[model samples]
Target: MRVRPELRHLFAAAFGLLVGSAASACGTDAVGIDACREIESARCEATQACGATEAEAMHCIDLYRDQCLHGLQSGQEPGADATARCVEAVHAVAACARAGAATMADCPAEPLVAAADPAAITPCVVIARKPEQLADCAFVAKPADTGTTTPSGNDAGDAAME
Candidate 1:
């Protein structure tokens, strides 16, 4: 999902803080900080390009943390190899999005469309089912039978879904 433009700054700040913490814990210097920032920037680019939310962007960064910051502590060259890995990671997410779009398109829209009040489905659930269709999903309301029950913020069930 496209993050609100205003929230982009929050994402950047959060990433910066994450990098700073990681760097400080490792006793990294200015160069290391720069490298970390570069990695975070690449992550942000991938997230935006992939239409991912801030959480998704953070998840992606966490997934590839090892490769993104490998050998930084030793002052060894953060080689092109690591950069290539970052690119690959971004492509992987893009591929998944494409696949999700295809799957969603092929899915029987009957279930979704046949609902008495299709306006009642949460955007997050729809997005989970089809990440690429997040924009389209946003306008879809939940079914009448589903009720307009917003889960408590603390509910983690949805997050654990495949």
Candidate 2:
């Protein structure tokens, strides 16, 4: 998703704060601090704009752990707010996955790209698919008869179906 220029600075600031917290928590080096900063920035931007609930936001944060922190330590530029952004992106994708499942009758199919590049998926898809279920839906991964699907949203439906 294209971040608005006006919000970009705000996201950056939020991210910087998150990263700073992470760095201080971990007590790492300058590179680690930089990586944390970047990750936080991306995460903040994605989360604010992701339109996901508090639970999804937390999930996204978990997803960003490796890409945002480890990649930086390994000397790889994981992109802007790589970790945090990735987490947010994954959460968005999860939201989409869940919405898609509702459309297909509780059997939300996982995105083909989920394993390859989950970050590419956006929450807009989820919002588009399950407009009514957003508040009630929760993120859940279902084992389909054909394969596995990770549905992002409230898991209330899954329980009802089972």
Candidate 3:
């Protein structure tokens, strides 16, 4: 059986296109922990301006790094480009807060998740400066209320943001 040269080329091209599309559909270039740290740092700085003490700020950063690392290991984080955009958005708000903006409403929200899979965007990129706001992000585990309390801003809510 002999196929024409043109038909062979067309089939090969179609196969190549199918393979390329499938590869693109699957996620690659996961957001690394380092980029997560940068994003957390930006959030911490912004929170500091919102009156979080230095110790609290450091704790927040640490907590976030741990969460980010866990997410990376668990394959739950977004792509590097998405996280980078998140970093930029968080930094912009941080800058605004540092410049004495009364509020940080301009900070970016968690990236929209595909409606088909609500949990697809697990390990959310936290941008909240306030404890209440941090509590609202999905996939973040909240600690049981311990009678012993930390500083105003560096409570369980702060820890959960990571």
Query: How good is model 3 by TM-score?
Result: 0.40
Candidate 1 worst ten-residue window by lDDT: 149-158
> Which candidate wins on lDDT?
3
Q: How does each model score on lDDT? A: 0.39, 0.39, 0.46
Backbone clashes, each candidate = 7, 15, 0
**lDDT by residue for model 2 (1-162), tens:** 999998999999999999999988986342443444343333333343334555654555455444344333234344444444444543554454445433322323333322323343334443322211222121122333554334422211111121
C-alpha RMSD values across all candidates = 19.8, 18.2, 14.7
lDDT of 1 by residue, 63-155 (tens): 445443432332434455554453344344444434553332333331233322334433233323322122221121222345432221111
Among all windows of 10 consecutive residues in model 2, the one with the lowest summed lDDT is 153-162
**What value of lDDT does candidate 3 attain over all alpha carbons?**
0.46
Top-TM-score structure, candidate number: 3
The C-alpha TM-scores of every prediction are 0.27, 0.24, 0.40
Cα TM-score of candidate 1: 0.27
